[model samples]
Target: MKGLYCRADAADAQPKFVIQETSLPEVLGSHQVRVQVKACGLSPLDFKVPKSVVDGCYQFKLSDKKIENRIAYWCEYKYEWLSVCLYVRPKPEKLSSVCVAAALRDALCAYTALHTHARMAVGHTLLVMDGASSFGLMCIQLASYHGVRVLTTSHSLQKHTFLEQLRPSVARVIQVYNGSSDLLPIVLEETGGLGVDIIIDSGVRLQEEEELKETKCLPHKHELISALGVGGHWVTSHQDLQLDPPDCRLLHLKSASVSFLNPETWTASSAQQGRYLHILKDILEKMAAGVLRPQPEDAVSLYEATVAMETVQHNQRKKAVVQL
Candidate 1:
């Protein structure tokens, strides 16, 4: 058996990725399936894992658990664990880790919107922040497929123009400038004075070092809490809300719920994970059947691996794969 390892050699480090040879331990359970990893998707958090900010931002303890322990959690519960070891990389160009990420994003958006947010009801409106990217576009398509209206926002004018050309499921496109003004009014107007049933804020701003330590009133935090509908939900993979703004009564007042979609949460054995996996498998099948398309693969390589050191750093929006 073979695997990838994160190495530490100051001069040799180009980026925090590595590939290596290793032997697999004997299988200890009948339920475990030894998957030959063909490819795996690299996320921004993967690059940030080595940084000090990750220690405070993410949910899992990198130093406390083994890779196998984390994998077992995901296998048992089907929660999306970001801290997963790549066991096998599938063959062929069409089936790769990037495809898996796209599938997962599609599934997450679909499930969160239809089942969790809107309860899969027809005619519900979905407002997606930063809707031009891969995840946002998938959310639009999935929501539209279920007869739901979608409204999205983008920071880039060029990207917005390009998205406009695509003629996606979007009912309206708004370009947000200053954070002071209320964008909700425009969103409500687009929905005929009825506010959106759901609002997905993917670009959540985190606290600055000084503010994180001292401030009680953060502008971005307040805006987010105020943006939600009477019973809206905010989902993010970046920061843990429980630790931030503990005094903010928004969670109790407007029925606002904040959930962190970290890798650890994905490792839970709850029925939700099964539902997510089912949705993901279905999306992958759709892609395999040529019913869906994704962004082109631009692969990046991992140079080496080492224990005790962080594995990824400064990850931009790119698809990275390790050759084992």
Candidate 2:
């Protein structure tokens, strides 16, 4: 198996990513299935996997699950779309992992965060803090598809046009320049003083530590308490958590919570990953029907994964798709 691999040369250090020929375990789990690897979504998870596992989630299904191929039309969601409200790196696409799954992996993660973790409903209002980023783009689209009023923030004016490709509802895109502080007023005003039902922060421009302390993330005692609804959920990406841990005490007042996306921590049997797969299968139909627009994909040759990964590292837009 020639795929991207990540392993720390030093035993005591963090794992770093590299592209090299790697072997897959000969023995397979009963639940696993081998994919032809026509295309695989490249994401941070690819580098973080500590093995040669790319987000080959594109075009694959678990052996035990009863997901009918699009041609067969097994059990699939009759609904127009499935919306999700949370955060980060694309999952592999449908059939393949677009969960044909590019940006779909990222979509699946958003779907999982919104549907499984946050318990998103049709009426829920989701605040996507980095509405223009690739991760944020999927979140916005899925939320809109499921009839959720999406409140998204974008700091980069240049990307606003691209963000519009996700098709957010009109007047819903809020521009925030000063990080959480600037976001305070916008969120408060948009949801009619009710705040957002959920918030998914996709590594948006984070404020400095001093600024973070001043803002205090929906401060427990401040004018911004209305930014987050009572008992709302905020799902921040794993990378962002290293820099900005949310204000726990402040969240406690409203009985709100902040969770990070770290699939590495969850056991295989845990419902968290299982639920994502379930969400993946459900939305595969939408991807096929064009209900959930596929985010732009930058396809690269699998043989050139070394160069492909460099693009993935600094990818500002377009989901990286590795064609094997």
Candidate 3:
């Protein structure tokens, strides 16, 4: 099998990825399938983070032999996008030969996190505190599919229009904010002061609070905490689920719940592993139905694989795929 790998020859040198031929298993393990490498998705983390941080997603799950970081379709089971996903569902070989189907599976992480961790329901509204993020973007769309109203915040003014345009018509996208901080009050007002049913912070909860250590920043953090409706569910990726005393008291009085979730832990348990596959199938179906937006694939050949990865690293969220 051919794979792109990160090689760090020296401790002081930054890791660089290069294509190399890899040896893989021949027989299927009943549960395993070797997806003919079709499309490989590139995430910003592909180049941004170190390989060790991501080893578990693909290296440990898919191949018994150690593989350098490159998963999500930059292609896992325990990571499944091996070449076999080419025809996981019905498809014309010509059309399926392209990377679109494999690219759609990239959404599984965000979708899985929201469904399992957030106690969301139809007709409910969620204030995605970090809307510009990949997870928040997908959450908005999937929630809309369930008939839930979504209000998202993106500090980037440029992204405001992009998000609105990117959102599917079926998604009841209620609002898109222009700034990250000073958003909770507007969020509360938008929901008629009831606050949102769920709040998803893409980074650690109240990460902005740690950035600016001034009196002005406290209100931003306070408003963020206050935006969680009475009994609303708050979910984010953080090592600590603890909150400041004031925020803690407010959530307590409101009977809201706070939970920490990590996409890295998506395949942690067997039950979650099963659910991940189901979600991937559904995402492919939705892409076919035009409900879910597909990543604009900057398809590259094996030799150009590094270029695709560079695109993801240099540019923030643009989707780049390497076709094998």
TM-score of each: 0.64, 0.67, 0.68
Tens digit of lDDT per residue, candidate 2, span 1-324? 676765545445544557676776666677554444456666543233432222222232356332323221111111123211221122323444333437555656777678766788888888876677666766777787788888776666666566665554624666554344556777777877778888876543343443453233322222232477999887766463433234555677789876766543332223345554456566665665666665465566767666565555555334566676
Order of quality (lDDT): 3, 2, 1
* Model 1 alpha-carbon drift over 4 Å, by segment: 7-16, 24-34, 44-98, 101-106, 109-114, 117-120, 177-182, 206-219, 242-253, 270-273, 288-292, 301-315, 318-324
Error of 2 at 252 (Å): 2.1
**TM-score head-to-head 1 vs 2, winner:** 2
Candidates, ranked, TM-score: 3, 2, 1
Output the better candidate (2/3) by TM-score. 3
Highest-scoring model, TM-score? 3
Q: Summarize candidate 3's per-residue lDDT along 159-232 as a digit string, tens digits.
A: 56666775552232333232245465677677888888877765443544464422221224455568877778
Could you tell me the TM-score of candidate 1? 0.64
lDDT of each: 0.51, 0.56, 0.57
Report per-prediction Cα RMSD to one decimal.
8.9, 9.4, 7.0
lDDT of 1 by residue, 22-89 (tens): 76557434433444443344433232234232222222223322222111112211112223322211
Q: Give the worst 10-residue stretch by lDDT in candidate 3.
A: 77-86
